[model samples]
Target: AALRELAAKAPDAIARLKGIGLSGQMHGATLLDEAGAVLRPCLLWNDTRSHDQAARLDELPAFRALSGNIVFPGFTAPKVLWVAEHEPEIFARTAKVLLPKDYLSYWLTGRMVSDMSDSAGTAWLDVGKRAWSPELLQHSGMRDDQMPELLEGTGLVGPLRGDLAAELGLPDGVQVVAGGGDNAASACGAPAISPACRARCILSAPISCTALNG
Candidate 1:
């Protein structure tokens, strides 16, 4: 919403600029069903008002060793902290702080969930074990309660939420599978999935095979 507003407000200025590419940042909080529908403002990924918290977390060796990711201001933890510290009013009202994928899934399924791949992108997960890292969450001044339930990559996420399904004219009970990160899903398709094939690039043959089988 904010991104669209910014783009519309300065299409020529923003679109004409070259050199470095620019993409709008959206607030993670605004993605939730309750907040999104209520017109809650978002906190963009690049909004670095949480630099102090991010810097503090960077000093914790356990964070890097466990998560295998640096505490960058763009990640959710920092953005979350920024909201908590600066916008207590909004923070108090937040139901959950979700990542981009999780946010979209919420609107689709009318359920909120975090899969391993998306969770790994946040600095709060232990990628090796594919679970949330307590230390990371604690250091970020967030609680595990703030995160959605973690599910495997192949798990059945849930059926589409009623209102959303109705809006899309999808039948009730339609399955909503847990989708992977786009690259990972492409990798799992066809020749890439086989050990004998080594194309070194994403191939569509496997995707076609899966689509046909389904």
Candidate 2:
């Protein structure tokens, strides 16, 4: 309906769209069932119910080795572990997991994918390698099949699907790029990534600071 309204107001809007770059809550988790339906309400980045699980995960040297960061209740990995322990049925039904922005991308492009930047906060990624960590997955009680394919932030994951494109009045081949998480997206175009940048980041208050390279 909103699409129709947008199309009514500017029929060329979608056609004019060159690409979609998304930035969203870094740790929110969306679990998808085998049929591609959402298994449950997403456990958002701010949800703190997973603290106990996160504390337990912090004990694993393997986890610290892979992720190079401390586990937090706000991270996706422990939240998933929380779900697995408290809601086994949902975990059993999950076929793929996505971060918040990836969930929107899945709806738009029908692809299950995530960018390295967004994936980093999941504590399921090998941050140094910028890829998923199988050891972390196993420790989290997740299988390889339950993770989305990882992509670089600027890599093209797919083009708009035919039906969705038609419905949205978008051109057939509008490219969809893998987007970073909220902080990473903000960090991408800054003029510099010096100690000054990091300093200002601390002053920014409440913003998640991540590593940035030129």
Candidate 3:
């Protein structure tokens, strides 16, 4: 496949690309169907040509308050806007827009979804409810129709689509758990789950030791 070919050539080409100031790579997988056909080329997160859209969103204090994060051109909504504006042809062809992990889940299960944590990063979700935020979408010049359905982080999105499973040499009915964003997963991997414990360890390691003893 094209990706395999790219990967094979990347090591040699990456350094040269870096030298030319085109060093960035997006960390997402391209989804494929049961027939091993590419659904679409995966959009890389570092594609930041949506600076205008990002700037407009960033100007709104509501964006930061609602999303609990600053608007960055690298995030999904801006990227979506970029596609809509610059690549209307591709945008028109898109059946679904998904984050990296969700795209993989789609390939595995033939389901399209927007996981809560990833949605939170998109500037398209109501952070408190963890659902699509219609107001944010409207403000961003996008419609709710353009967004994927939402799913809780621990919820079952679907099972692996049978033919895809067989083709991948995986068993049928592999459960596709709605996954969280990279940050949320990384937090779950930490030594302590509690905020106080983590804060103590991070702020004062000696204090964490004392607290552990006492």
Candidate 4:
């Protein structure tokens, strides 16, 4: 509805647009079945039902070292473990896992892909390598096939679906960029370019603190 409203308000601008960039809350797990149907309600970043799982994962030094972040209950990996334990059926049927923004990107572009900053919070990425960690995925009982293809936030994610473009009254082939997580995107909006500079977003619930690196 919000997108439609925006499109309606500025048809000319929409037509003139070259590409669409997405930014959404990080860590939320959006699982999809083989047919691309949502398997369950997305477990959001603030959800803490996976505390036990997080604690267990945190005890494993490799998780913290590889992810370069604490194994928080709100992160996607713990949530996946929680789902596997509490909702095995859904876990068994899950063919793909995506962060919130990537899920939206899939809807728009028909491609299963994710970006670095968002995937970083999943506790399944090698932070330094900027890629998925096979060991971490093994620990989480997730397979590489279930993960989305990764790209940098600036990478191209092909074009929007033809039907969606027509429905929104926009030109066909509006490219979708592999955008970042909310905090990372917010950091890009400010003039925080060095390690000494920090960007904070208090407006968002569960406010984010981002460290800008040169």
lDDT of 2 by residue, 39-139 (tens): 99999999999999999998999778889889989999999999999999999888889999999888888998999888889989988887788889998
**CA lDDT of each prediction against the hidden true structure:** 0.62, 0.84, 0.62, 0.89
- In the range 1-214, model 4's lDDT, one tens digit per residue, is 7768888999888878889999999999999999999999999999999999999999999998989888999999999999999999999999999999999999999999999989998999998888899999988789999999999999999999999988877788899999999878866675344444533322333244444354
lDDT of 3 by residue, 118-171 (tens): 777777777887777777777755667656688777778777677864554444
Write down the TM-score of every candidate. 0.66, 0.86, 0.70, 0.90
Worst 10 residues of 1 by lDDT: 18-27
- Window of ten residues with lowest summed lDDT in model 3: 17-26
Find the candidate with the highest lDDT and give its number.
4
**CA deviation > 4 Å runs, candidate 2:** 1-14, 189-214
**What tens digits encode model 1's per-residue C-alpha lDDT throughout 1-214?**
6534555687665454322111122224342434445225565555677778788777889878988878877667777666677766766666566766666666666667777665665678888878888778877566677677888766766766767545544455656665654445555654467755443443555234322221
lDDT of 1 at 108: 63
Indicate the TM-score of model 1: 0.66
Can you tell me which runs of candidate 1 are displaced by over 4 Å? Answer: 1-39, 46-49, 182-214
Q: Give candidate 3 regions above 4 Å deviation.
A: 1-40, 93-95, 201-214
Using TM-score as the measure, name the better of candidate 1 and candidate 3: 3
Clash totals, every prediction: 3, 0, 0, 0
